[model samples]
Target: MTVTATLAGLDPTTLGDALRVAGSPGFDRWQDQIRRTGGCSDPIHLTGTTVTRDRDTGQVLHSYSTEAEPGGRLRVACGNRRASRCPSCAWTYAGDTYHLIRAGLTGDPAKGTPHTVRNHPRVFATLTAPSFGPVHNRPGRGHRPCRCGIHHPADAPELGTALDPAAYDYAGAVLWNNHAGHLWRYVTIYLPRELAKCAGITQRELRERLRISYGKVAEYQKRGAIHFHAVIRLDGPDGPDTAPPAWATRDLLTNALRTAAARAEVALPAVGDQPARVLRWGTQLDVQAIGAFGHGEDLTEQAVASYVAKYATKAAEATGTVDRRIGELSELDKLPDLPDHTRRLIRACRDLDALYPDRKLWQWAHMLGFRGHFSTKSRRYSTTLGALRQVRADYRAAQQRAALGLPDPDDHPEATTLTLAHWAYAGHGHTPGESWLAATIARDIQHNRDTAREHRAALDTAGEW
Candidate 1:
């Protein structure tokens, strides 16, 4: 068959481009690059040269350049943590988050946490934003009608929409999202003081005797407000490596968290016509002890870790908003399908930005004015995301070194090697055909992961039996 005939069924625009790529000698190399990035949807293209040499003798240890790669550029994962932006990178990020949280709850010797942490007083606490106004909701078990007087279906588009849009406090809701991070900081400060009160000691004495460590992830409620789910732990003064003092009990930790959350508040000065406001956590505080293993009415360590990791890859997009920054109010007009409630919230951000320029509300209007990391942890909570990423990078580097027959860095402890590299961003993303292939690779990789996980789970179940 003729080449044109063979390509007839393919997408018209990408067919010629696909043919050109497939006919090229660098086709395999391009595919290899995509595979190396785990098929990132928007891989960054970089042009660079790197050289590793012995410091003293200046002996060349390794040399590499992107000039030999496909199109004389190297493609790397963008490492975006938002699943709406890049699922492959987000999946990797979620895995790292899971391990980081798990290590804190159950401990991991490799991550510098001792198993004794499982015995530490740990609680899974959820801090929610106060109600701006009543909204449509499914009172799941109670079978009660919404305040607006209707039973909404599970998939109703209006579920989270305001029952009375005109009366809803859009300004307050967005402002709360903007100051959510600040409110969390207040909680941290008050938490220690509350702990001191529970132990019948002064704040100064509490610092020397005990420490509070936690890993928290911010989640967007359907109503576009930010809420926090955290695994709060009480550790000895030295951290997870040491056991907490006798006075530090699980009940003590839970009570302290409840009191701290109640007392935590952020006072915002009046901006223009906007009135002064004090933001505090919602009254619906949920604090539950984390069990070492799954049991009746107790959250398991693994369950809590998985729950936090799941949200780590999400953002305000969960509230039916755009995943990227809203360039201007005009952009909102272009999205005809955007929920009216969400549109009003975006408008609130744009309007507030004029008075509160420092908050950069307009710049983050897409996020409903939230401008904080979705996931965060205290210093002694567990290993950091950076540490987890570095471990993966080091492992990959070691594998590459082994493949190239290079000596391990540990082998030449006294002989230091210096690396010099310069990289310039060329571009990003892929052509239509390349995107199709990359998506296929991503699906295959995910499938492999799922299969491996299921196999291990089956083995564990059998062992339990």
Candidate 2:
């Protein structure tokens, strides 16, 4: 497992490229930049200069430039949330999502949420799409054979593919995905009314006495359909900080959610030869009460947070499709060994795009016609991703300032510091050798994190004993 031995096995061109980077005088500095970006697969290249000066005295305090850096450029993380695009950035995104969801459930004082939120009536609900047609699947309970008369393995490639492609309603499935976000919006709108009805009160009175807060993430099923998993909480009118009304209970919330989901529907007008359709949630609905501690069937705060975070970094790639946008129908043919079911789904998107210009099906063909944000939250759902990122940015900036021996901006308020900066995009992506090196660094970082997490878990278990 030596670096030299690993390099020896690489192709000649890659070996030569790696050796060139290793031999460069600025190699260490370049490595540091890569480390800072967490080994982003496709980093953005920038050329910039920044000068900070005292506002009162007009005295220059600090200055930075890429003039002396490797390649006269700075490398920054692309910050794409899709794991298929960039795993390092996606890992960071997932971590933020975990904290955001956790704060709303268990509460994080530092993130401005009080611990009282954990006592609030909360439920984890999964909303699924109505089936368009029969597909090959593993039957629940009994080990039944598929419609084609064969017991499929867990990893079978044809698991989600239609038993008969001609019989599958590809257009209906794609249309449902395109309007999934709208359906969720309708559910939110109908939720409070349902809740009020259960309490024998009007929707207006419910709004005055209580508020509904939620955090949700969309996950793609193997059938290329979009489903939602949400953490819904009943909060006071003002939000999580205040106590909910006496009438607010887990059972009531659960019942309201079930009713709201059933009532929320989207209507689509006829397109071409397609008939007018009404889209609604599937019969399979799961609503479970969240417990402070996972006891028996109850899902714990930690487990729910982890589950939602897991899918925040995923897209339609789980359905055996490409990650990037598909420009033309002709391009689908050029794709390497594209699955037949996936190809049809993509083709459906293209076909409908012309008739439904507003839906932008072609633009989201890669996503199987689903274009909504993967992760979303109500305004009162604890902290936000932007705020979490800002905290990290501020901390890193403070560290850099300390390293440069610059006075803290907070320390000298009498003389305010003015920062001026300008940056232009250069090129991006790594050389073949650099890609290998970056992958190695990413793996190392992940391994270290995994080891630390396992160690902490072991200590916790030992303490319990």
Candidate 3:
């Protein structure tokens, strides 16, 4: 129990290294940060090379190498797939996502506005998955009839369930999810034609008069259905299109969407006894104007931006599924306590893996049967995660310089200064004491978010900025 007793048989250099990493001033804050990070839980620690050029001459004057950090270990914040994984990093990601989406809609990088975007008609839309076979679901008010003619209990386990499991169309639901992106693309493409027709304009000429701009995200409903929520905007040529037709109302956009969803369907390759598959949006597609005045369930630019950003960090595992990068097929049957539906999804992805051997679905076997990008957007929609990461990198680098008392804008390209670094993944995760700290750090972040939400709620109530 005594210090000497614990160190009695330890190697001197190894013990000294331990003491330094654990107790040195340089590592105290870092250790605290690591403890806060909870082993980064899902940190994306990266090691890479940066090549910078002279602003005027465009000559490659400087290259900062991290190839030598311990084990070549470079302690970059792990970009997480879930907020639950790392709040500090996720929060930063979420904030960056917000601004990225916001800038696309509002067009102001600093204040997240285009000044002209507000003049456009924008709506937040949510389209949910069709019933696979109802599991439990949130209660509804003033409920509609269940075509089955039986009133299901508000908390009843029968909601969203297909009356017959054998005929429940699970294949369609899964495939719908798999091809949902394609269906969405079809809609995006079709909308222009429909809008043009409705507006008495040619498809090619549609852009001359108006444009459709949107940002959307997919979410899972409890019964294993993938639904989408979107922010749809009607803009002009330069985005948030300047000239609006008298017909460019929220009602018009909603009408165009409804019509498209009804008719939009894509034929995917067939499987099992199932006939050729035709993928489509769920039977229930809700498009409402986003506003507080009950104008249209106003998906305000800010609210929609934030809402979509929140879902950006989630992975399939959050829904009791896996991330799908399985080491082997045999591993699928051994995923501990996974639910049947999730297990089925994983198998499906494994099967689909044969179709796109390059994507390696079997490799990502934990992600169920789907192997597609989780969140993506059109280039014009906004900034990117990479861009956001760069901003933070620049900020942190500046801070590092400030700490060393380097000159402001340390833009020097001098390569006279030699560099040496080396690091290995000293094995991920924390000692018990560090785990304790990581939890504390996460709690602090959640608390801050809650407090900020409360402040915003108060502001909304008072109608003040």
TM-score of each: 0.94, 0.97, 0.74
Could you give the candidate ranking by TM-score, starting with the highest? Answer: 2, 1, 3
Model 3 CA lDDT for position 224: 60
**Stretches > 4 Å off in candidate 1:** 1-11, 54-61, 294-297, 414-416
Per-residue lDDT of candidate 1, residues 65-113 (tens digit): 9989989999999999999989999999999999999999999988878
Residue 216 lDDT, candidate 1, scale 0-100:
98
Model 3, position 238: C-alpha lDDT score: 61
Question: What C-alpha lDDT, on a 0 to 100 scale, does residue 403 get in candidate 1?
Answer: 89
Candidate 3 residue runs with Cα over 4 Å from true position: 1-27, 32-39, 44-74, 84-87, 104-113, 133-166, 241-243, 269-273, 292-299, 328-336, 350-365, 410-427, 431-433, 448-465
lDDT of 3 by residue, 1-465 (tens): 012344345466655655545454445445444543434654434466665554555565445555554334345456665665565676767777787777766566553336566567767778765555544343454264565666566655455455555555555566666666667777887877878777777887888777787777777665566777787778776654264666788888888888877777887555454478666677788876665333454356677778888877766644576553567667757767766656665666666666655546456555443445666766555567787778777887678657654434446655223323343443454444334444545665678778998999899899884
**Error at 33, model 3, angstroms:** 4.2
Off by over 4 Å in 2: 294-298
Model 1 — TM-score against the truth? 0.94
Ten contiguous residues with the weakest lDDT in model 1: 1-10
Task: Please give the distance, in angstroms, between residue 62's alpha carbon in candidate 2 and its true position after superposition.
Answer: 2.1
Candidate 3 TM-score over all chains jointly: 0.74
The most accurate candidate by lDDT is: 2
